[model samples]
Target: MARDADATKVRILAAATDEFAAHGFAGGRVERIAARAQSNVRMIYAYYGGKSGLFDATVAEALRRMAENVPPRPQDLAGWAGDVFDHHQRYPEVLRLSMWAQLERPEAGAEPREIYEDKALAVATVAARPLSPIDVLVFIYAIAQAWQLSPGGLTGLEEDPAGGDGVAARRQSVVVAVERMVHAQP
Candidate 1:
């Protein structure tokens, strides 16, 4: 029974992830999620309370998966940046989901202070100097996501075809930028 319950929850969460990623919290439909998951609306409410609850859970799960899959490596910040960029490129829905959450439920997505504190501590442990880890992290993340968020603004790939190497060039630019940031003197 516990196994069945867990399986049901996984299915529901998977379905919810797709729905929320595609339609966001405001546009996502509980009925569509239920049908996709082969579960009923009551089960969704019982498991997740409501659409907001489900969205929160979905976002939380996505974050957890990201952390597990591509943890930060202060020793190799450039590699880590590339990995993060690759992950974002492959799973763009994660970014979309985050953007949707921020746009639709600004107040709800505020991560707990402890999460930030823990990350800061982790960064401090591996970082070379006393530079703020958060700053480094944010810069690397922004560089990695910039192309995806607004390719035309950064690389002009959207307007002109720089051949098939444009994406590779953009990715290399992110890696080089991260390398510079990591090596730069504070």
Candidate 2:
């Protein structure tokens, strides 16, 4: 039945997410994904065309999940930053996978770039009418990456240092600062 087929596809995708998260695309094996999904290799190819297609699907799905968690809000930069910071904490693997995709093939990141640009433009709409959506997107992502990496500051956002409350506060501060920079009145 169509329902059965859909269920199988979902299973494969879920399994693939985990496998790919643990291992980069070059390292991920189809057999491992099939086994984890409790399905067969044939099913994966049938539904996703091939490993490349599956990887693209997985990347798209991860971006979709992030978008769902952080909806577009022109005046909710703090909330959006928190959502994104938390998303990175909860699903760091997604970030790693995306990084891998970018390093492996820059073109592969185009679709996700478009998704992020559209979402960011919606949030930063109050900025100068001619704001480059790509710039806004890069700014948001750069902030998130800085917070996540925290070079000389916090290590991991989830693990609050002895006294530091959490990464949320630090992230909120950065978000507000960036908002001012992006939406500054001309």
Candidate 3:
């Protein structure tokens, strides 16, 4: 009985995650989540307090899942980048919903942003030994932003002929050259 109840809550949470990841806080509907979960609306309120609380829980769960998959560390930078790229590729709606939450309710979304900041600082700390703080931040941010813009893993043929994999390869070469340039300097 207890196990069954727990399973139901987990199913509800999963349904809420998908719903929130698609519609965000302002657009998300409890009835839809309930229907998707095969549960009733009152179950959501009973389990999570209400829609806002569920949104917070859903966002926290989303970030928690991402953090678990990515784990913060300098050694895992490239792997983390790949994980993030794969996640966004598989679930662009999640990213879009996140962007919408940020735009619509900055205050309500503070926890997720704080989580991002903590992850960034952790990455910065690990990377700072070899690169300046600003440089590390820039490097991570650039890789993330560039990956988001390019779906084919950041170095593939694209809409712009001059900006295809060949160009990306060259750009990467230049970035490496610049990193070595800065590192080797007295």
Question: Using Cα atoms with residue i matched to residue i, what is each candidate's TM-score against the true structure?
Answer: 0.87, 0.80, 0.67
For all predictions, the C-alpha RMSD in Å is 2.7, 3.5, 5.4
Candidate with maximal lDDT: 1
Q: Which digits, one per residue and each the tens of the lDDT, describe model 2 over residues 8-38?
A: 8889988988888778788899999999898
Candidate 1, superposed: residue stretches over 4 Å from native: 1-3, 110-116, 127-130, 151-164
Against the unseen true structure, what C-alpha lDDT does each candidate score?
0.80, 0.73, 0.65
- lDDT score at residue 25, model 1, on the 0-100 scale: 91
Residue 28 displacement (Å), model 1: 0.5
Candidate 3 segments whose C-alpha is farther than 4 A from its true place: 1-3, 127-142, 145-186
Candidate achieving the largest TM-score: 1
Over the stretch 1-186, how does candidate 1's per-residue lDDT look in tens digits?
Answer: 244778888999999889999999999999999999988899999999988898888887877777667777878888888888888977887788888888998799623345455656767787476467788777878998888788555556355535556667778889999888878886
How good is model 3 by TM-score? 0.67
Tell me the lDDT of model 1 at 142.
90
Global local distance difference test of model 2:
0.73
What's the CA error at residue 39 for candidate 1, in Å?
0.7
What's the true lDDT of residue 81 in model 2?
61
